[model samples]
Target: MNVRHLIPTAAVAGAVVLGLTALSACSTSDAADRRPGDKLNVVASFYPMQFLAEEIGGTHVSVSTLTKPGVEPHDLELSPRQIGGLGDADYILYLKGIQPAVDDAIKLSESTHSVDAAKLTTLEDHGTETGGDEHGHEHEGEGAGADPHIWLDPVKYAEVAKGVGASLEKTDPGHAADYRKNTDALVKKLDTLNTAYKTGLRNTATKTFITTHSAFGYLAERYGLVQEGIAGIDPEAEPSPARIQEIHTIAEKSKATTVFFETLASDKTAKTVATDTGLRTDVLDPLEGITDKSKGDNYFEVMQSNLAALQKALGAK
Candidate 1:
């Protein structure tokens, strides 16, 4: 189940900035214990990163997550113990900017073997209706933030898998072959998922789908669809009355039949918008965290559920 227990405490700043790096007090090349399959201690910032670590690292790593199941990741605050444990990890995986506290702590980490998955792929602004640049622009410069939810897009997530595999190989040369093989396998699965999305959404009645947050920008861009978010990239941001009215018009004009809310986030906004727009509400998990309430157990299963929901909402042909 890979469930993490919540910790309550203040963060002790300074840990982790991933540059395709390795970790641990032991050296992989010379350690006899590591040669005998001593698992690397890995810390993942959240579910998406945790999934990558578990699937790609396979039997070579012991993984733990900072974000507990069913918890809203953006609201996650790290306890000092959790932050302190980062220094002991052989590898740390996290998507920068998704969890602000973790991002702040990772920026301070001295480890060179850590990986920021966001750096492995391209990120674009999806422009939430609440407030953001609607035009797809590069969020490269300082003060211009890019969305960090790239895992939702299979194509982009595969790019990250390649980077992580290469990095893991360098860190653990003894198991380099295993890491490479696992990475290829994971990427192949992602490729298959991408093909399915392309075929399923190709003949949809409408390209626009309304969502509570703008987490699916990369997914929408990859699939040639439009995502109209009620709030900005920040999931908790309240939509103004004007923005609500704007969505009503958008739903009517675009023929959007559903309002999608995430499992972790509150469905209040989605229901309100759906009620006002004469649209039905459904689940469109962002894959942030999986729980019993999620449509399916793992990343692939939940993503498939999302596909079915989108298919129905978009009236896929």
Candidate 2:
């Protein structure tokens, strides 16, 4: 199935924000009334969550994403309509702590069944050298406590898929067998993807890679590679002068071929690092969202492209 990436205009964004305010004061009885549809109504937090919902739920589900394409997920603020209309959907699948506003809104929402994917995997602290202070903690958000880029690791993503499938089964027991079958198929594909990454990155000349942010920790960990980020887990956070200097030093020491930036975030830091270290720059997407700027349409294609970039940068045989 071809998934068309949605981009909301400024007017729509305003409406959503306004809807949130309206929801606080108004009744949502009008919104809660379900329309006739056999497909389960699923609202995903972002691209990765949306992918899992669609893949696991298949034609039995009608999936939508809260975060639009090309927008950074961390900066998302729920519209009043989105907040007020939570009960209109059957389930809301999200990665907890990644979006604080979403977390706050979800807590207030009593209507939708919220499924957090973060619980499906173990989290690790990939805190920056400058992450101990108050400013650092705020900048890191969910990332300060633990890295939330679990979806980058195929095995962990498959685990999340399993959990989501279980939720779907519980919610729609009549389709339990279908959900199980679809989940198994999705897991098989993810396993193949895992093998592809392992084989492609195997015995690279260098194990150390540089990225704009520390979002690739899980991916690097999966493939036995070392990740050096210009910024912390939060892409919006600025690296201090000391941290920048340290990154440059590490780049020189590791002989990193390319400094990588993500599609959704600024490439300024990565470009600056590249300029300082005399290295090239390229994209290594975290699969947060899909935009026209993305090299591929969906998760699998983009991940394969990422694998190729890693192989080139690491000088894989």
> Candidate 1 lDDT, tens digit per residue, 73-144?
877766655665666677889987666677767666655567899889877744431213244422211123
Error of 1 at 80 (Å): 1.0
Q: Cα deviation of 202 in candidate 1 (Å)?
A: 0.3
Q: Give the Å shift of residue 89 in candidate 1.
A: 0.4
Clashing pairs in 2: 16-79, 16-80, 19-80, 19-81, 20-80, 20-81
lDDT by residue for model 2 (1-317), tens:
00112223454445545656666664433213444456778888889999999998988888888889987787776666676566567788999867765666666565447898988777766453212221233232223457677888999999999999998898877788999999999999999999999999997888878876667777887898887766655454566777767767766777678889988877887887777778889999988899999989999999999999999999999
Highest TM-score, which number? 1
lDDT per model vs. reference: 0.76, 0.76
Q: Candidate 1 — which residues are off by over 4 angstroms?
A: 1-35, 126-144
- In angstroms, the error of model 1 at 5 is 19
Lowest summed lDDT window (length 10), candidate 1:
1-10
Question: Candidate 1 local accuracy as lDDT?
Answer: 0.76
> Per-residue error at 267 for model 2, in Å?
1.3
TM-score of 2: 0.84
